[model samples]
Target: MARWRAAAFAAFLFLLLAVHCRGGKTGICYGRNADDLPSPDKVARLVQQQSIKYVRIYDTNIDVIRAFANTSVELMVGVPNADLLAFSQYQSNVDTWLKNSVLPYYPATAITHITVGAEITESPVNVSALVVPAMRNVLAALKKAGLHKKITISSTHSLGILSRSFPPSAGAFNSSYAHFLKPMLEFLVENQAPFMVDLYPYYAYQNSPSNVSLNYALFSPQSQGVIDPNTGLVYTNMFDAQVDSIFFALMALNFKTLKIMITETGWPNKGAAKETGATPDNAQTYNTNLIRHVVNDSGTPAKPGEEIDVYIFSLFNENRKPGIESERNWGLFSPDQSAIYSLDWTGRGNVDIMTGGNITGSNGTWCVASTNVSETALQNALNWACGPGDVDCSAIQPSQPCYQPDTLISHASYAFNMYYQKKGATDVACSFGGAGVRTTKDPSYDACFYLDSEKIINTNSTPPPAPSASSPSLPGLCFTLLLPVLPIVIASGFL
Candidate 1:
C-alpha cells in the first residue's frame, strides 16, 4: 500500500509539472534603439508583469542586464552591426568587452546567449564579410574566459539571404553570399549555436497582396494552402512554408544538423498608405495564430516534432525607430506601456481578472502595474511552465502584476487541445490553448465554437449580443491575443 501511495504521489507531481510547461509560450525581443522608453528596471518590470521569461536585446546594456538580476528570465544580448567591423579586427577589444560588460553580470542577470551581429547576412554593406571574424573572436574570448560552454554565440539573419523561397523544397541560399556563409555555418555547428533567422510572412503578403491568399498567410483553415511540387509537401500557412524554406536551405548546404531558431517574427499594427495590409486586427491575428501554432509545437513539414524556439519581434514599439512607419509598428506593446492587444493563454475566456484597473471587457488601456510579480503564484506558474532547470526554487522573487485576465467560461464548450513536443522528449503532449474565436453579442461563446489540433469546431450559430456595452468586440476568425491575460476586444477582417 505504501509503495502504491508513493507511485500515486509521483504521478500527481508529474502531472503538475506537465501542466506548468504547456500552452502558448512566447518571448519578446526588447530592442531599445529609441531613447524615450522607460529605464531598464522599469522595462524589466513590464516584461515580468506580462510573465515573459525570454528577452533578446540589441546590445549588452549594463543597466538592462543588471536590472534583470536574480530574475528567472533568460536573456540574449547582441553585438550591433556597426561594432562587427571592430570586433572582428580587435581581439583584445572582444576580451575587454566581455570582461567589462558580460562577465560581471553572468548567472545573476540570466544572460544565456550573445548575438554577434544583427541581420548581418542581409545587410547591404560589405559588413557581412566581417561577421565570421567577429563571431570567431567573440567565441575565442568566451573560451578564454572559460565561459564558452555556458553562453552561446550566434547572429540573426534576415530571410533576404534566400535566393528563392517559393516552392520551399527548392529553397536555396543566395550564391553571392556563399563565400561568407560556408565558414559561418561551420562555426555555428562547431559551437552548437542555432542558425537564427528573422522571418516576416507579413512582408510577403504586403508586398504582393494580390498574389498571396489572406487565409493562407493568416493560418485560416478555409484557405487551400500551397503545395511544393518538388517535395510534394502541402503548407497551410506562410509561416510554416517560410520555416520549411529555411530548413531546405540548410539541408542543401548539408548542415542538416544545425538547429533553426526564429530570432524575430511579428506583424505591424499600422503602416503607410502603400502598406495597406498593416492594421491592428491583422497584427493581432498573425501574432496570436503564430503563438498558438508555436506553443502547440507545430513544426514545419520537413521537421515535425521539432520544437521551434522563437522570439517575437519586440516587447514595446519604439517611437524613435528611423524607418518606414511600419518599422515602429511591430511591438506587442505601445510606447506608453499599454498592450497593443490581448492574448488568450487560457482557452476559456470571460473571467474578469482585469489587472491594473483595466475593467474586464473594456476598451480602456491597462498596463502591468509592477516590475516584479507576486513570487508565490508566478513561481508556482513558472515551475509549472519550465521544467526544473538549475533554477533555485527558493530564491525566486515576486514578478510585477501580470496582465489580469478574466475568464467568462461558465461551461466546457468543447475539449480544446494544444499539443507540443517536449524539448527532449520523444512523445508529443497536449500543450498550448487552441480555442477558436467568435464575435457576437452572445455571452455564451461556448455555444458558437469547438476546437481541435488542426481544425476549429464550428457550431455556426450567430452568437447572441455581448453582455454589456463594455464587452470587447467579438473575437476575430483566426486571430486573438493568446498570451498576456489582459482584457482585449476583438474585431474581424485581415488588417
Candidate 2:
C-alpha cells in the first residue's frame, strides 16, 4: 500500500511540474521605441497569428494595451525608469497610474505581471535606489484595488548584478549593488514573483572572442563543453552556464529556491563589419536551438528537469535605436511584420530547411500524416484542408481518380500534398500542426496525376498569387503571409 501511494504521488508531482512549466512558458518582448512600425492592432493580430501566448512590453501604451484586450496573450507591463521617482514617492500616484493605465483594461488585457523599472541596477545610484520604493507603492496600490493577488510585481535585471560568475559555484552579487538588491530579492520572495533577468550570450561571446568558444555560445552540437571544476557539471551551451551562474549567486545570498525568469535573450540578425558571428544563419541557429532547449525543458546541470521560463528580446527590429548595428537587429520580426527567420516555439519534430537560398523547398516534397500522429488530428486536418483550406478534395472523394481502398490516411495524403502545392511548397505550409509531415517520396497513384514539388516551385507553371482582401478571395484556400515567411497561426487554413 505504501509503495502504491508513493508511485501515485510521484506521477502527480510530474504532472504538477508540467503545469508549472506551462504557466512559465516561452514569451517574447514587444518593444515599440521605433518609428516605422505597424499599428498596435495589426501587431496584436500578428502575435496571435504566430500562436505566441505570453508577451512583455516596455510600457502600458494604451494603444498596445487596447490591442491585446480579450486575447489569450498574457501580458507583463512595465513602469519605466522615468516614472520611478513619482511612483515611489506617492501611493496616490501609483493608484492614479493603475486606474488610468491598468484597471480599465483588467480581465480583457490579461496583465499578469507589473515589471517596475527595467535593469535598475544598470541605472544611476539615485534611480536604482527608487526601484524598491516604487515597487512597494505599486504593490500597495495593487492591494488596494484587490489586484495584488492576481497580478505579480517584479523588476528586470542585467547579469552585471553578479560580480563573480565564472565557475558556476563561485557566482555572487556585486558588493556595490547589494544594498539595492537584497531588499528587492526579499520582496520578490515574499511576493512569490520570479527574479527577472536579461541574459545575452551573444554579447558575452562577442566581447571575449579570445576566451569564449563561438560554437558553445551558439549552442552548437559539436562544441566541446565547459566542465565547472567545483560542481563537475558540463555546460555545452553558454545559455545554461550563464543561467546557473545567477542560480548560484542567489543560493550564496541564502535565497536558495527563488524562481528566475529570463526576461531578454536573443541574437542580433545583423551587425557591423567586425561582428563576425552576427549573420542571418547564425541568428537562426541560435534562436532555433534556444527554442529547442526551452521546449525540451532541458534545465541547467545544477537543476535538471527544472522549468526556466524565457522571453526572447524584441519582437520587431528597431531602426531608430542608437547603438551598434547589432543592437538594431535583435528582432525576430522585421519592421514590416515579416519574420526574420522561421522558428517553432515548441521545437517538436524536424525543422524544414530551405536549400540554395530558395524557399521553394528541397528537390522533392510529399505530404503525409506524421508518425505517431493521432487519427483525430489527421481527421481534423483533412476536414480543414478539404473544407475551409479549399484543397481539391474531389480527387479523394468516392470513386474518384485518387480514391482507392478508401482509408483516412489515403484521403489525408492527397489533400495535404495538394494544399502544400498551393502554398508555393514552402516548408511551413506542409506542417498541419504536428499531424502532417513532408516527404520526398511521391504518393501518387495511377490515373491520379499529382503535381511534383518542383512543378509548384516553377514560376512559369505555378498557381497565381493569392488575391487581396478587396479582390475575389479563393474559397477555403489558405495563403502564406506575404512578407518574409513567418510562424504558423492557430486556426490556420492548412490545419
Candidate 3:
C-alpha cells in the first residue's frame, strides 16, 4: 500500500510540474499620451481589478511606478529614444536614471524588464547607432546594482526590420540595418533577452486587403490556411505567420536561440472610412483570439509548443496620438475606465466582447473538489488553481478564516470555486482535470465563503456588457496554489 501510494504521488507531482513549466503570459500596454487618462493610482487599481498580471509602460513614470508598489503586477519600464543618446554617452547617466527611477521602487513594484528604447529602427531620425551602447550602459548599471539578473535589458523593434516575410522560412532582415542589427542580436543572445517586436496583423491587412483576407488576419475559423512553400508549413492565422517570419529572420542571421516577445499587438476599434477592416466586431475578434492564442501556449508553425509572452497595445485610447483614427483607437478601455469590450485575462472562456453583457446569470453555482476523486488528483488541481489559474488563495492560508478545516479538500474547494467564479462560473471552468464538480449547495463553512458568479462582476466605472456566445470555448488552463502544509497533510495520512 505504501509503495503504491508513493508511485501515485510521484505521478501526480510530475503532472503538476508539467503544468507549472508551461509558459506564455499575456500582458497589457499602459499608454498615457492622452490628457483624459485616469490618475496613476486609479489606473493601477483598474489593472489589479482586471487581474492583469503583466504590464508594459512606455517610460519610467515615477507616479506609475509607485502606483503598482506592493501589487502582484509585474512591470516592463522603458527608456525613451531621446534618452538613449544621453544614456549611451555615459554609464553614470544610466546609473543616475536607474537610481532615481528604478531603485526607489523595484521589488515592491515587481519591475521585470528595462526596455532601452521603443522601435528605434523605425524612428524618423537615425538614432539607431546608440541603441546597443545604451543597452550596454543599462546592463552595466544593473550589474552595479546587482539587479542584472533580476531585470532583463532589451529593446523593442518594428516588423519593418524584416525585408522578406513571405513563405516564413525565407524571411531575412534588411542588410541596411546590419551595422546595428548584428550587434543587437549578439547582445540579446549573450544576455539571454528576448527580441521584442511589435506585430500588427491589422496593418498587414490594411496595407494589402487584396492579398491578406480579413478572416485570416482575424484568426477566424473560416479562414483558409496559408502554406509556406519552402517548408510545407501551414499558417492558419497571420499572427503565427508574422511570428514565424521573425523566427526565420533570426535563424537566417544565425541567432536562432533567442526567444521572441510581442511587445505590442492589437486591432483598432474604430478608424477612418477607408480603413474598411477596422470595426468593433473585427477588433474584438482579433484581440480575443490573440489573447487565447498567446495564453494557450499555441506557438507559431516554426516553433511548435514554445511559449511566447505577449502584451496587447494601449490599455486606453490616446486622443492626442497623431495619425489616422485607427492609430488612436487601439485601447481595450476608454478614458473613463470603462471596458470597451470585456476580456477574460485568464484566457479560458469564449464569450464575445463586441455585443457584451454580464458573463452568466447563474449566481448560486459553486465549484468544489470531488469527494470521489483520488487525493492526488485533488492536490494536482489545487496547485494548478493557485498558480497559473490565478485564483486568490490567500484566504486559505494559516490564521486566515478558511484555515480551520486544514484538509486538502477544503483548500482545494476554496481555490476551485475562485477559479470557477473568475472564469464566468462556467461548467468548463469547474473541470479541474475531472477532480472538481459544480454544486448548487453552498460550500461555505463558517467564515469560509466560496465566491459566486455575481461577485465576479466587472469593477470598471461602467458595468461591462453581458457576454455573447459567439466565440468557441478554449481549453481551461489549470492554476497551482502553493500550499505550505501539503507535505504535512500527506505525512499525516489525510488522503
- The digit string of per-residue lDDT tens for model 2 on 129-241 reads 89999999999999999989999999999998889888877889999987779999999999999999999999989999888988778776435567677856666678888
Q: Rank the candidates by TM-score, best first.
A: 3, 2, 1
Q: Rate the local accuracy (lDDT) of all candidates.
A: 0.65, 0.77, 0.81
- On residues 1-495, what C-alpha lDDT tens digit does candidate 3 reach at each position? 755666565555556557655569899999998999999999999999999999999999999999999989999999999998999899889999999999999899999998988998889889989999999999999999999999999999999999988878888999999999999999999999999999999999999999999978987644555867676665768988999999999988889999999999999989999998888777777877787666656566567546899999879999999999998998989999998877777766553333434345335878888786667667877887787566788999999999879999999999989877765565435655456677889888788777676655543237435534432122223323324435764886734
The most accurate candidate by TM-score is: 3
lDDT (Cα) of model 3: 0.81
Error of 3 at 67 (Å): 0.4
* Stretch of 10 with least lDDT, candidate 2: 481-490
| Candidate 1 regions with alpha-carbon error over 4 angstroms | 1-25, 345-495
Every model's TM-score? 0.68, 0.69, 0.71
- Candidate rank order under lDDT: 3, 2, 1
Worst 10 residues of 3 by lDDT: 471-480
RMSD of each: 16.3, 14.5, 13.9
Clashing pairs counted in every model? 33, 3, 15
Best by lDDT: 3
